[model samples]
Target: MQKINKINQYLLENYPSIWNTRLVWMLLLGIAIHIIFFFIGFVSHGSPSTLQHTRAIDDYFSTGLVFVHIIISVLLIVGWLIFMFKNNAFKNFYPGSRNKLFLEFLQYFIIVFVSTTFYFSYMTGFRLFINYKYDDETMAKNVDIINRSVPFLSQNIEDYTLENRLSPKPFVDFYCETDINKIDKTKKYFVYHDRVYQYFRLYPKTVKQTDERGQFIYPEEEKKNKTALAYFENNNDDKSRTYYFKQQVEDLSQYIKTAAPSYYNYSAVFYDNANNPSTDIRKYRYENDINNLNNKEIYKQKQIVINRETIRILEKKSSKELEKLMEDFLAVSRDFDIANNLNARDWSAMVYHPDTFEVRSFIKLYQTKPNEIYDPNKAPEGRYGDYTKTVVVDSAAVSSDNYLNENGEIMQDTISARDFNPNLDREVSPKDYFKNNISGFYYYTSDLETFLGNVDTIKTDDFFWDAVHLYIWIAFALSVFIFSFRVTDLRSLLFSVISAGVIILAVTLFCVAVAFTFGFKGTFFILYTILVVGLLILLMPFITAGRFPKVVSSVFMIISMMAFPLFIWLIFGIVNEHQVAGCRSQVYVSDTYLNCRGVLDDFGLKISYAMIMFTFVFLYLYTGFIRKWKALPE
Candidate 1:
């Protein structure tokens, strides 16, 4: 019994060679490494991460990637378990070699590939999913995604009209409604857009069904055009159109999102593939007789039914009667909802009257009362937070809402930028946008708002840094493959292992440098493929370091470098545009920002060029092949 007990103890102690080796440890270590990189990417990327914090931490993290990470983690653990339990796994993985040290180092390479493949799956899957703008279930439908979403080419600016829905209500925080209680009736009011004369409708006490030019831009259409259209929005303003983003990208972050509520302006939003019945609400587009006010009569609703008999138009020719009508109209409307169904007059500006229909604010046309021109001296200040200074830009001189007294004298109710001039302030104004109109300046705020996010490279890292992460893993993978063939002679074995390592790192490092110059794009995969092919081509020709077949290796490496570039050129040429390329969005964004990621264009060529230079240097340094090919026998 004593003999058997000692024998059992000895077997147990010697069987497991390394205490650190355990299925749990393998999984833990692999998972830890992945997590480390993921976190680094998250930080460098500066986007929200699902794993960095617990559920309680909501301020900065996105829950979007959490479940996917959990699934990946579980899969990795399973893979580790499979590797640990299968006895034959070693037979296929770890092989003997003449150089014990090389063999030992190679073992680590083996594990990384198996583990990496498992970890790499998450990225691959996510990228594939990204090809779809929204989840399978929630892609925008009925409401066709504004032409920018699909196809290699899209519509031009002229194709769009005042009614084009390419841009939804994209900004929320900036617009605010003015108090109607203070009206400078005689002074022509100006809206940023709709540069037209305002003829007040007597019956509705609002802007007549149409304006002087017959352009039917009502409340919402006018505001959107002022902010997003014109020279700034379309580059039509001067020589540039993509306002703020295209022209005034002073602070990229500020443009990231106008505010939290309006993400579509900045953020690339997507829903879960399984999300049922997408949240798109384009079905309830309102229709009323507001399209043609000249012919249509108003609807009088009682007990949830319309009574057309009550739709008589009371014509008040005098100013007092008009004033009473205006008062009645103002008091009646809390919001304007229905618009452009029939005519401008058909639109209703309800005063908290939820039943007639909810219009936030509709047109209000009144008879023009002759008033003094705007006096910058009277209204010294504006309600906006501060007078913002501009750069050397061609901006229009802007005035704030006028400050008037009860007697209608131009009083200092508000202030004007006392020293504002386009040359001095360099900021565009509503007047600049609405060059044609100063008539009743229409202003109102709407909940039709948007949120935005900037598509930017994580500030903490650049393409070079991103390349380094891959280098380490690649190094590990190459070392494993080279060291696995441990049956060769010591000189040859050492030569092969070192040669493989140098080639792997050379190609990768060269790629790193080239990628930084060009852009990350597909350089990594290109270099990786080249390195792989180069190794395969060189393997048979250069069996050992002593027998270094310099020409074979050089030829192989050259081919490897050229292959990636040739493929890149072929792809770009065939596609006819950048759309088909990988992560071209990054390239597009970079082009906007001093062409920061411009390196993507020539990365493949740069890599090939680098290899040529390397070849020349290598040939000059290594003049002749090793005279006595084989190293001394180990």
Candidate 2:
């Protein structure tokens, strides 16, 4: 404590101007105020678990604390700037020789450097502590919640899936049947599956056959074949008959391949018997076997192939088959594609019975008009299960109020993938829908809002407030430059400001050129160039002593000093732009919501860059000052 007092006494007595500078007072006071706020929060919040105080104070009380911090910071800066003007500390220092000039510059540089160093160190230290506290508190809370819930949720687990309409308990059952019998035969069967949905709409499953006059239908055998024959005869004049022929060809090929492999073998054997009997006998030991190839399968395959080939031949012979067919089809029915284009919206939900250890599942499917996923008039035509009991999985869950209008149709503003569809009768597992959503029974929570609402809200005001704190120091530095004119005269002040502007402009243009030429590589080079140029400017005064040279030297000094605060801010802006862009592009994950988690890391990196630049500038000034002082004649 005595050593600290001696050092303080030394600075106060020997470097009175430096000791009295606003820069020093502001930093010292700002840091003291921050420490007070930290202590207040630690006490009021009870230890640290309840202290959600981030770098940007979360609680109302913390915000008030920050307000006080800002007020003190402003007062310190304003009060010190006033003191500099009143005391004429700016004119107190002057050098008789090169050595003395260097010594004077060194003294001023140390004051500014130490002030800046202390200011940043305190700000960053306070922020780091707050951030760590928040992280630790969040972890503790989550761990406690998990610890309490784990044992209760671990028992009687059954894999509930929407695909099979399976329930965790045997007593719970689904009403919907996915089986694909004909709509008429099943009384009530939904064509929810893609294969069945497309098939029934596109092609007639039970095509009716007619006699010569086309007056009466016949209950005939080979129903599809007979129907195809009748359709061909009736539409022989119309070129659209080719569609039927083409469809027949496809059906025949598939049927022959899938239904009658034995017939294919029989045909191969017949050809070999007639053309290469010796080779055939060598290849097949089943030549005399009774079950070698069945007659019934051979006959069935032959008839199908013959019928299809005949239709295919007729189709090829028809002129402009596709064009005429399309025209005729359109002419007959303009809405031919309407049914095929039905909008299919699927929704899945899981219902957990915490009391009975049963999880009821529901998959609501809506086959609606084209582009109509939600219909207000109809409330998903009475499904077999309890629709009210259904609940969305974590990923699929969203408030209906966000999407649905007063009339129950999708609102204009809230039409997105997350919007709930009222025409919806589907429930797909959140896991199945997102594939990336959380899995396991342990992840389920009865209150989704409660689970998710605890997330920290991103208050952009916090960042701006933090930035304001930084800019206050920048304002102080700039004020020093402007106020330095009181001692140096208006001419020097004008020259410094103009020269600084020109230098910055030149540097900016050069950076642009380099960036264009070499891309990021060039920008990196420019950054190094800035470092070199900054050092050169700091040392330039030691090399010359003319009035113009003095003016130029003073200009560069002020510009370099002023640029320090802005340079750090510029680096921050660039990093911030990059981080925001990155976070915007990225999909949200559990640990992050809109880049909130990276705030501390981002700020830390900026501070680090600032520290590096400041250190380089300091070293160059200090080295030049000492060298000149040592070289002076005693």
Candidate 3:
């Protein structure tokens, strides 16, 4: 007891500046924690040098995994933070000394004001500054090589754009609204891209499997495995998931008796798809799949025979005529890639339903989808998938963005004005267009025959908003926390700006660190939510005491608060959008929503919740709602 009393007396006697000492200690603490977190993230996620090699899309794929790492790190940060904040060690990382007055101001600034503002900025906003930037024809030729410099990293197309998706009427008529009976029995309709071949029906119908029983009691296609049959029998699980895929092989000889009609392989398996359709399905598909190679070789030969005959007919036509037809087909094809390099002699086309088992004949030596297929970087279901079939042309390096719309109920074509001069609807740009004759018009009819081969329309989603967007939403909470707390004193303003900045910076470093390690895009938004809420939740306890007045010190925080999101917009511009190289700019990319959205959907609508929050926060501070704490230092 004597020793304890002596120690207390000695500390008071020797160190009259306990608060100054603590401020130094807290600053150090923040720096150390930041360092440790950075190291851990670096170790687990791999260094930035390593990440540079990993493609941007690869990072996207592992979003869930990355976030888990963030969660674990957050727990660690929180544990250390408890030690620091509870013992008042958090002041070590800041400039303020241990002086009681300084420590008081530092706490308000470091913990509350800064963190909320910045992290929200990170999520919703982005910008870039770029121009054609000194690339001539030769450099343009080398652009592909430059972007592909990363080993194993390849650019991909984000297919969510309107160009890639089927027209709503056709997408629903052909792919979406379905009757199994109608699809299989009545084909002979256009299926989008350039299949222009004969089919008895649009889709074939067969009873999808349930248990070992085929919809058709045919013993030939019965479920082979006992366990498979049992699982298939569970209608709740199997039927909900299973559906039949059936189509009739056309006996084309009836139309052209001279051509031999062969019943060949009913189906073929493809890797990426049927344009370059692989006979090899050993990698991902079940070994026992009907499309499996071991069992399908005999069927392959027959299909080959049919394919060969079709190729021969295509050859009989002058290659020039065929090339023109193909170029035209490519130009009007929505979501197709018409490249410079294609087998001018031959190109193949294909289409399939993803959710259905109803894939068609795997055509080879055909067309390839462009590298820039239409998918936006938004959310799943954000856009359509790759629509072009990869076709190889002799000495062809295809780069044009022309494609026959994915095989659909109708085909969209561009007819030269000289071909058919329709009356002009409006002003025409004759720059690339030939001597004009046709009036601009687009139309569609229920009867397939009445459809005009050409049509046009346009719009942009400049202000499209979505609720699922992460940045837009968390800004809402941050805005509210900033605005809602009533602070009349100047320190209220001081605490807010200071703490908001520090806290936001710390949280962002922490969040990005964790996201880097674990691959969590979702966590980006969640961290934004947590920091904004945490600032509000944790600070609620400190508001009553002057010693803890970092909670609400300054008043009239409106001006700065209202400008927060705009400030973020400015930052993205300065940083040039921080995106991976070898990609097009996304600064003005339109917003979109997934079927299930929480907060970001509003951004798609162009509604700024962050702005709203800032306004309210500014209002709260201006109204003198924040009470003064006596001990809060100036």
Cα lDDT computed for each candidate against the true fold: 0.30, 0.36, 0.30
Which tens-of-lDDT digit does each residue in 1-634 have in candidate 2?
9975776578678865455454354456656655655455444433322321222234433446546545555565456557666755445444344444434434444444333333333444444544454454663354333322221221111112212211122101212211122112223222211111101112222334434543234224434453322111213222121112112211112222211001111111111111111112212221233223334344334333432332342235433442343233222122111111111111011222222222232222223334544321232443221112222223223212233321235543333322222223464433343222322222112121111222222211243345544544544454455434533556767887788778779888888887777765543466566666666665565554343445555565555555555555555545655565567568444333444433336566457445545644553454454344334333
CA deviation > 4 Å runs, candidate 1: 1-111, 120-135, 138-352, 355-472, 475-599, 602-632
- Model 1, span 1-634: residue lDDT tens: 9975665456447633221123234545766666554453334322222111222122223634444545654575456546544543332333222333333443444444434533243332332332232222332231122111111001011111111111222212121112222222343322212111111211111222334543322334334443221111111122221212111111123222221111122111111112111111111112222322211111101100111111111112233432344333333122221111112122222212222211122221112235644321121132221112121112221122443332226644342232212232443333342222223322111100000011111111133333434544453434333332322323544455466577669767877787788876673466456745554653543453335454444433333322333444334443323333444555433333443333334464454444434533432232222211212232
Best by TM-score: 2
lDDT (tens digit, per residue) of candidate 3 on 362-383: 2211122345222212212321
Task: Provide the global lDDT of candidate 3 against the true structure.
Answer: 0.30
Q: By TM-score, is 1 or 3 better?
A: 1
Residue 271, model 2, lDDT = 15
